[model samples]
Target: MAEMTQITPFVNCRDLAAQRRFFEDMLGFTCGFQADNYAFLRRDNVAVRLLEVDFNLDDPARQQMVYIDVDDVDALWAELEPALSKLPEGRARAPFNQPYNQREFHVSDEGACLFLFGQGIEPSA
Candidate 1:
């Protein structure tokens, strides 16, 4: 059996340049590799693949989503809050603890893919 190493989500976007800028500028992701049609972006251990695709209005597409596990959700939120508010639909909801015991916040890119940055909270002492 082949051992599973890692899972990287591929997101389809209309413009590679815009997608690359969003990840690099807004979310602090570094571009690992880039081609005309594809880009791989990384931050710490998380990697996201972006593919350039033509948007079809006739056939509506489902939004792509990625959850980035972070060491500190609040700190990330504090850093990202100001910039996130400027993009179209880029506003982030305040971080909150979930039933799953993770404190998380949601932000969307210009491409419409949602990213949830979260940190796992320990049980109360």
Candidate 2:
């Protein structure tokens, strides 16, 4: 059997420049490669690809969600809190424990892609 190496998600956004900024400035991802309509961003081991697309933002079907597993969700959230606070209300959420045995922090980018950062925790008693 071939061993799977890594998985990178391709995200569609209305504005590539703004999306790139969100990934880099907000999420701490560095741009590995970029073109007129596409960009490859990486932070530590995770990677994401941003593609410029013409899509209806009003359509709920066009929204995307990406879940990222982290070693420490709270630490990551603290580092991003200052920047996240500048976003409009409801764009960022504080880290919280979930019934699923994970602590998660949720944030939405300018393109409305929801990114969830989570860390595994002991199951609640």
Candidate 3:
């Protein structure tokens, strides 16, 4: 079988610049490469590519979601809360352990992509 290589999501957003700004300033992705209509960004070991498109707010498309497994959810929240809270709807939902056994919170970036940062829930004492 052919060896499987990297799989990076190519996101389509309304504004490329806004998406770049959000990923850089808000989500901490560094632009590794760029072109007229697209950019490749990376943070740590994760990579994502963004493409500019005429996105419709009313389009019944599957929402884009990114799950970031973090070591300290609380610390990440504290660092980002102040900036996130200022967005029109960028408020980060308080972290809660899910039924699937993960503690996570959701934050929406400028392009309306939902990012869920999570950690494994500790067992009750």
**Which sections of candidate 1 miss by over 4 Å?**
1-3, 57-61, 122-125
Please tell me which predicted candidate would have the highest lDDT against the true structure: 2
Candidate 3 lDDT by residue in tens digits, 27-76: 77899899999999998777889988775733657457778888888888
Candidate 2, residue 93: how far the Cα is off, in Å: 0.3
Instruction: Give each model's whole-structure lDDT.
Output: 0.83, 0.92, 0.79
Return the TM-score for each candidate structure: 0.83, 0.95, 0.82
RMSD per prediction, one decimal?
Answer: 2.6, 0.9, 2.5
81-114: candidate 2 lDDT, tens digit per residue: 9888888899999999999999999999888589
After superposition of all CA atoms, the RMSD between model 3 and the true structure is 2.5
For model 1, residues 1-125, the per-residue Cα lDDT tens digits are 99986789998888899889998888889998998999999888889999988875224466677888889999998887777777765356779888888899998776768789999998655
Question: TM-score of model 2 relative to the true fold?
Answer: 0.95
Q: How many clashing pairs per prediction, in order?
A: 0, 0, 0
Segments of candidate 3 deviating more than 4 angstroms: 1-7, 55-57, 123-125
